[model samples]
Target: MKFLLLSILISVAAAKISTIKVTGTVLCRKQKQPGLEVVLKESDSFTPDDKLSQTTTNKDGFFEISGQDDEWGSIEPYVYIFHHCRILKEGCRTRSRYDVPQPVINGVYEMSYIDLDIAQSGETYEC
Candidate 1:
């Protein structure tokens, strides 16, 4: 009877789920800007994986990405962010490639409420 009870408890513990809430904004390195479209990504590592990601951002530069409960328990769940600007100039064209200048957030190992203010010019992106 003790063995059976122990097994059941272990099963229940393995099935536990938790939610992580990530929120942040994007702005210029020198200028404190707002209302920019920022792209945020969560990955098992720095590399992209089909089964490991969620992305959401708004014009105010705010973003949120919820991950699978087990994702945070892994080693260094990578987070990336980029600048998403709309091209408006007739003569000047925007760059085609998404700017993954660096890891806006990195090495996540715990449940967190994060806030990111990112800059591309070798400046630190905070959370």
Candidate 2:
């Protein structure tokens, strides 16, 4: 019984932890937004929890967010891009949400081309 319990503990210790890697872009008024904030968190949640990670877009409006969760599949992650969007220039969502796929163990999830674009109103594109 002692040996069996030890083996189980070892297996649990070796279980893979999940770390999410996300990369994407932010566009506003049809232009790349540098220094804009990009946030990663649990999607569809209102727990007042802190974000898993936060980053700023690069000069070309690109960003990367990476962080580790205690366990795999514990959180449904999403990206948020907050920008000041001009009306009629580019259609967008204010607290834009983009799904980050469930990651493989210790894997890199390269979300290379997500465009978090701001829009004219909530009526368009229902993002």
Candidate 3:
């Protein structure tokens, strides 16, 4: 049992560390949408998704977030945007998730421009 525990500990310690940076701009009704929340996260198979970084869009509706994680395999990175782009209800917003492509791992992933006025496939409403 001791030997097995030692091996497991060593393997966990040897997990690979990966880093990613993401940048994007948000637009609502063809105008820059400021103050929207943006989050960088890592998707996990057996556990809750990990939040890497979080920030709000600037006055220009531009946001930049970066994160790092250690895992047995490559980290699956994504971005979640929370905004009140189209909803009229007070204190309600929509959350959208965008997965980073594998080719952009370990480097900067430019999302270009995201227009919140256009609905996404898997977006959800939140309060």
Candidate 4:
């Protein structure tokens, strides 16, 4: 019984260190907006010490960022976009919190393209 419990604990520990990968695009005014900074952060970590993972949008306004953490689904995940749309107010526009979807029998997910277009709302970076 003690050995079984130890084995279960080890399996749970291993599951928590999985990596997260998310990809999306940036669009402003119905066009691909390039040269923007995109970032991913832990949704529940108000003061998370984890290093932020970020990437710049390509010529086509696409970006991909990934990181490893055991707190994936429990903490949730969010993306931040830094663009000129909020030049007067703030440097970044944050989207609503979302959970990383789990793939078939796996912990990783391939998300659909999320568009950060300013023309749609003209407020902040609304995806």
Candidate 5:
């Protein structure tokens, strides 16, 4: 009976979910200007490995990422800021990757408001 109870407790503990709310903004490099269609990515740690969640910015250049720990139990959460530049023009069909440096996230599982300011050069082309 004790063993069965222990197993049940473990299962319950494993089911407990840790949630995080990620928010940020995108801006142009030259004047720290706000832009549209900014892309956001979540991964474990600040590195490229261990993807957790993803989201996009609104017209106000703001974005939010929310999910439970259970959703990413096998992976950690790291936030990546990016955007799609170079529309369907000559040699501009592909989207480019823009990596924000370390500490992109303010806090994990905390009610913190963070903002990301992306520069013009960070884009494949001007927005």
Candidate 6:
């Protein structure tokens, strides 16, 4: 009905839009890792995390990505990196997630050089 639609519109308009920027470099065995997938996501408690943006690392193994989402409160942002470092299996990659710190929520979060040769905590293998 009209009343229900109005309420929904109001709630949607009231949600706050938050944006985040992230940049980093990836290295595998001390060499630049290109064509690695990087994703920016907004974590959700009751549903699947929303993917805001995704990109592959450049030839220099550098990536810069930004995204925004609307939420009732501040959006919880994180980065996922998929790479084929130290993997013996075929058609599989290692996935790693890095949560953006609260202090750098609204600002640019810079992850300096990340060496994929070293295993990251909580990383998983995915096909």
For model 1, give the RMSD to the true fold: 9.9
TM-score of each: 0.36, 0.61, 0.93, 0.58, 0.41, 0.88
| Candidate number of the best TM-score | 3
Error of 3 at 44 (Å): 0.5
lDDT on C-alpha atoms for all candidate structures: 0.39, 0.64, 0.92, 0.60, 0.45, 0.92
Pairs in steric clash, model 3: none
Compared with the true structure, what per-residue lDDT tens digits does model 6 show for residues 28-94?
Answer: 9899989999999999999999999999999999999999999988999999999989999999999
Off by over 4 Å in 3: none
lDDT of prediction 5: 0.45
Residue 113 alpha-carbon offset, candidate 5, angstroms? 10
RMSD of each: 9.9, 6.6, 1.2, 6.1, 7.6, 1.8
Model 1 earns a TM-score of 0.36
lDDT of 2 at 41: 75
User: What are the runs in model 6 whose C-alpha is more than 4 Å off?
Assistant: 1-10
Report the lDDT tens digits of candidate 4 across residue range 25-86: 66666678788777766644556545448788899888887876565344355566666643
Clashes of each: 0, 4, 0, 1, 7, 0
Mind giving the per-residue lDDT tens digits that candidate 5 earns over 1-127?
9999999888777764444555654444322313433333435454455344666666655666655454224324444444433244554322334444334333443213232332334334543
Candidate rank order under TM-score: 3, 6, 2, 4, 5, 1
TM-score of 3: 0.93
